[model samples]
Target chain A: MRISMDLELQDRPGQLKHVLTPISDLGGNIASIVHHHDKKTFRNTVPVSVIFDIEEQTLEELQEGLEKNGVAIVRIGKMRLRARTHILLIGHIIHTNLRETIDEIDGTGFAEVQDLSLSMPAIDGPSSAVITIMATGDEELKKSIGILRQIAERKDLLFIEPLDERGSPGGVSNEE
Target chain B: MRNSQSTLTLSIIGFGAVGQGVATIVQNVPHIKVVAIADSKGVARMPDLNDVLARKRGGQPIANSNLTALDVIRTIDHDVVVEVTPTNIQGGEPGLTHVREALKNKRNVVTSNKGPLVAAFDELTQLAYTNGVALRYEATVGGAMPIVNLIRDTLAGARVLDIRGVLNGTCNYILTRMAEEALDYDQVLSEAQDMGIAEADPTYDVAGIDTACKVIILANAFFGRHATFADVDVTGIDRITQDALQLARQRGFAVKLVGDVQELTVSPKLIPIAHPLNVSGTLNAASILTDTAGEITVAGKGAGSIETASAILSDVLSLMRDRT
Candidate 1:
């Protein structure tokens, strides 16, 4: 599988090679290594993104191997997932913690709130927000919607979900 | 008869409980053939598997050859090698060497042994990848409970946040009995040993080493995190007092030996009775906290000769599917 990992490394003579060796040892073929040594911090740590393809189980060993060797992994894999779906949430979007709402979706590990746009005319008036979600696939997207629906109900807000192309009347007309 | 499916030859190393169990199940399968069998006593070419099993059941050696398990793996002409040897944590031993030989020979491997995987997970898995062979060990973690396959096959793209499992059937049985009867750890352990649920030594199971191995395997399989027995913060149920169980019971909780991969903890923890991890008896369960599926829990018989053999069969069938 192809995976991209963001790592912070010390700007030493062989710091980059030290991080790259584990990936190679664990049967991962390094695709690219982007080192930002020019933007090294005062502590001499540079942010690097390494892309590699590895066997399924090797990925875990590589991760542990890296951690054991003191390599700081910021994130692994693609930040944006496949299959994007847009949904709208209405009513007191900000009053109910918007960060929590986003986190609830992001925490699922299968889906994330990729982008959001919110509008509130008055402080007391009901607000609306449009959220674009990146999910693993259809089934995961459905689960994400299910969680959002429950949150919306408990928060007493209106949630307009994404229209399913296969089940929607507008989609049928467009197909015809 | 002309057919599209290919017949796969299999070599079995370590003719113990798990090895015999696989042979028993494969008796009904026509596509897979057992060509070679190796045990501590000797190694033999078993073209007629029924006769070999009959000899083994009758307390006679299958054959007398000077071949080591590694030697059979190297010289044998088989599509796959099923390694069912005992686990040796110190250095992953004969099983590790056997696995390496099998992968080097371009043969797939399905094993119930935890030693090699725990000792050299990265190197062995890397070897398999380099040699274009698959190494599957579903029976290593939860026996027939399907913990490894559930996370690896079903939850493919789902990112796992944390994994908590009742991985050891022996520990689970002891703790369950201790709580249910309000008995001491020693009493419950003796009962488990009498019932064949635990080994005579019982240190491996009761001391949390077995559970630690399972959690380590899960950590690597899901989170790509490698951990060893030392990494797990282990606290066994031997010190759990009856009063603690009773107090937890009053508070609507049950004491369970929970193994968490993310935290690398294997200890007796208080879980609500209604929780999915709160399973009883020899049943093993795993709760996988994934980003998309939320928390998915699976529970079943964790260890048994036939049950584990069923997992081995599943891995064998998986290999067949990939080859076809």
Candidate 2:
């Protein structure tokens, strides 16, 4: 499983190496390392974020080893929603049962509506909304979009999807 | 390069905006002689360029010869036929017949018409091949934007994976104005019509049919897909709301009508504000994804009399050089 962790290390030279040794020694493959040297904690410790993939059983042992090395573990999170996409819907959204439309996607379990912004100009006029959907992977995100497309069609809403960075049809990358 | 020894003679069939634009540009080109010019009213054979332009400007019929456009295509001893007729998507009329007759007669054809291509791409192309003549339509898709030839010549040997972009300038202009000014679709459409950016009957531009025709041509030309107007799944920009444009703007996106050539689909897609295909106003941009050269984007004026004539001129010159 992919994991992201926040670590606060001492300002001294070997602090970063000290924290990385246990992660590598425990057979963890590091994906990224973002050191926050400018935004030091009040305790004079530097904050660093490390992302890696390792066996679930070895996570606890690695944490224990880091603590023994004087590394303050701030937070750890499993990166579930790695793929995301934003889509726009224009029509009588509220009257068409926006809750049920969202439920159809959230009910998939693999994908969920992460953010939504609605705009209604008047009471009887058509409404517009931009909904951000996050999923576990690319395929799940595509399936969720397909589901939403069907929902949009049935509800007579005009659905506008984002063209990928390469201008192809798929989820837009978060890095953009 | 022009052949100085002998002049290359060609006829302009269809004296509309694009046809007149061709006439205006060819007057400066020394080696190409305009042998005939035709409009809906009649045909003028072995015509003078200045007189044809003046007559067309004065709203007078340009007919001086008894020969029709087909008759000229059949009997005129010309090296090339510049078919700048209006697009007839339904049957690819007049343009299709002119192109077919030209190719069958072994005379090269250069056209800015999309109707003939979208209607009978395979048949017309096959006909050109069988007669061992070139049938080039560089101005058909994007006016003045060198896409068909850019991929065919400059990006030679690169495997084209897909192509997608803003193919219609009218739609792009309306969307850009609506998004930038936060105006409704109808208001912006009226503004476009008043400025002559859109047709008075804006159904073709707004309904996504024009973009769909361009998509069909690109699909058949590059992807080797035998597609037609019916093959494209289209969605127009007429129903897009100003609120939706504003909401998309807040998230660093601009709504543009993008046509996907590979998928044969045209719809209003939310493009990231900084993306290459996110060109504003009446400009047209296309992103060509290829395996060898990576993604190459091109943007330029999508429509105009002289701009479209420039593409047609390129094809004519290329044909002249090839023959030389």
TM-scores of chain A across candidates = 0.52, 0.57
Model 1 TM = 0.64
Residue A39 shift from truth in candidate 2, angstroms: 20
Q: Judge candidate 2 at residue A12 and give its lDDT.
A: 87
Residue B72 error for model 1, in Å? 1.1
Interface RMSD for candidates 1 onward, in order? 21.8, 2.0
lDDT of 1: 0.79
- Candidate 2 at residue B202, lDDT? 96
Candidate lDDT values, in order: 0.79, 0.90
- TM-score, per-candidate, Cα-based: 0.64, 0.86
TM-score of chain A of 1: 0.52
DockQ, each predicted model: 0.01, 0.52
Query: Which run of 10 residues does model 2 chain B get worst, by summed lDDT?
Result: B1-10
